[model samples]
Target: MNIVDFSKEEFQNQQIEASHLEEILKDFRRDGYVIFKDIFSKDYINELNADFIDKYGHLFSEEYKKNVFRVGHRRIQVSVELKKSFNTPYLYANPFILPVLEGIFNTEFIISDLTCVTSLPGAKYMPLHRDGAIFKGVALAPLLPAYAVGLLIPLIPFTKLNGPTRYWPGSHRSPLHSGAFEGNPNFIEPEIETGSCILMDYRIVHCGNPNQSDEKRPLLYCNYSLPWYFDSSNFRFDPHLIVDDNNYSDIPEEYKSLFQRRNMKLQ
Candidate 1:
């Protein structure tokens, strides 16, 4: 299936029925992950693609000139464009996204950071790791019971051949003991279509499978957590600054809400 074929209008018009939501939540709780097919519209995808290209196109050139990893490679601690993209209101209040989160974590949640990944052909496999590793340095005295959930939206179709994500079904329940499963030979890769989204527990042991196909696998990962936890994007970008004053009047309600700053009191 061509993952990039649908426009934004089509996505916005797509209705997610009650049954689908029930099945999704059930699979998520049972399997640690669930795929919602064709949740994004082509227009949104195009806008996102153009936005990313205009902002980070330089990375591609730099990679070419330096003979470095360009497509389908792991790049961490990247620039702020990815965060800004995720902060866009359309994503925050996505019809299919929020409800699922509310179902699992109840109503209280805020997106903490965004990770944009583009896996080009021949991209190397990622080491299995839990998203909760970020909390390792916090002192136990003030240790809060914060949890993070990863919302992975694929801009391009995801398949075993295109480096789909591999996950351990029940590993989230015992994250510390999940260990590295990618090299264990028992890992299973889930086939996901473009515009599909997957919600995962931060403690789940997982990794990006290597891409063997010729197409690029681009995905946008939005990490959500309670407001008290440290945000991965807080130090790098301010969500407020990215909004254009002139465009405020035209901004969608959802977008406006996502960009609103929250106050976090240190315990």
Candidate 2:
């Protein structure tokens, strides 16, 4: 199955049951992506949405226009401030997410990016692209193991009329580039609930579907990578992420290393 329904699974200390780990990994490794349903509660998602609205609800407002990056025709990616509700561990170091990531890397991983990509009404489909290249100019780039992955949490439910993401299954292992997926019949755009989160390899070919509905669709995008890796693409206008000194200090000791790039002077 493309989506793993974790809502019915048993949980020990808020982590998925051990029995489901194999299936989750299998789907991820084979398809280069997987979706976990019911990763968070609706109340939690509502709170996150509220927090995001407080800061960036008005997309064209004078205060936040400077913080917005025009990613597509009507789609904008805004860097989230790592303070208050945005910096909470429940959102970043989620229990249901970290274990699956650990299995994929089999080593320590660090969070490299945190931003929200909002698709406004009339937002068009994006050019199929990978968030980060594994090893540019290398012949064996596609064959290499995943060096980075993206964790997407939607603040609102992703609907068919809204801008749900479309993915080409198992594309991460192929030598295909962004242009390879056009006219490809094999694609899936799973309608995800607010609490569910999608995990995808960095090399996968995917794009956002147009938002035919009137409501805006905002997705919290988080990238995690091997400690040695850094993303050199997709942030030409903005920095990789934002985390102030106070927020960095608020992170749990175990996850502090994930924000190693944060410096005291950063605003």
- TM-scores for every predicted model: 0.70, 0.91
- 97-142 in candidate 2: lDDT tens per residue? 8888988999888887788898888888998887778655577888
Off by over 4 Å in 2: 7-9, 61-67, 136-139, 263-267
lDDT by residue for model 1 (1-267), tens: 111223455456654556765766777666566665566666676677667667755655444535433222543222233244444556766766777777777656665655466776667877777666454434441133326778787766677788888877666654344454645765567687655677787766887788799765677777777655554433333341233454444556645554343322122
**Cα distance off (Å), candidate 2, residue 241:** 2.6
TM-score of decoy 2: 0.91
Best candidate per lDDT, number? Answer: 2
Model 2, residue 115: displacement in angstroms? 0.3
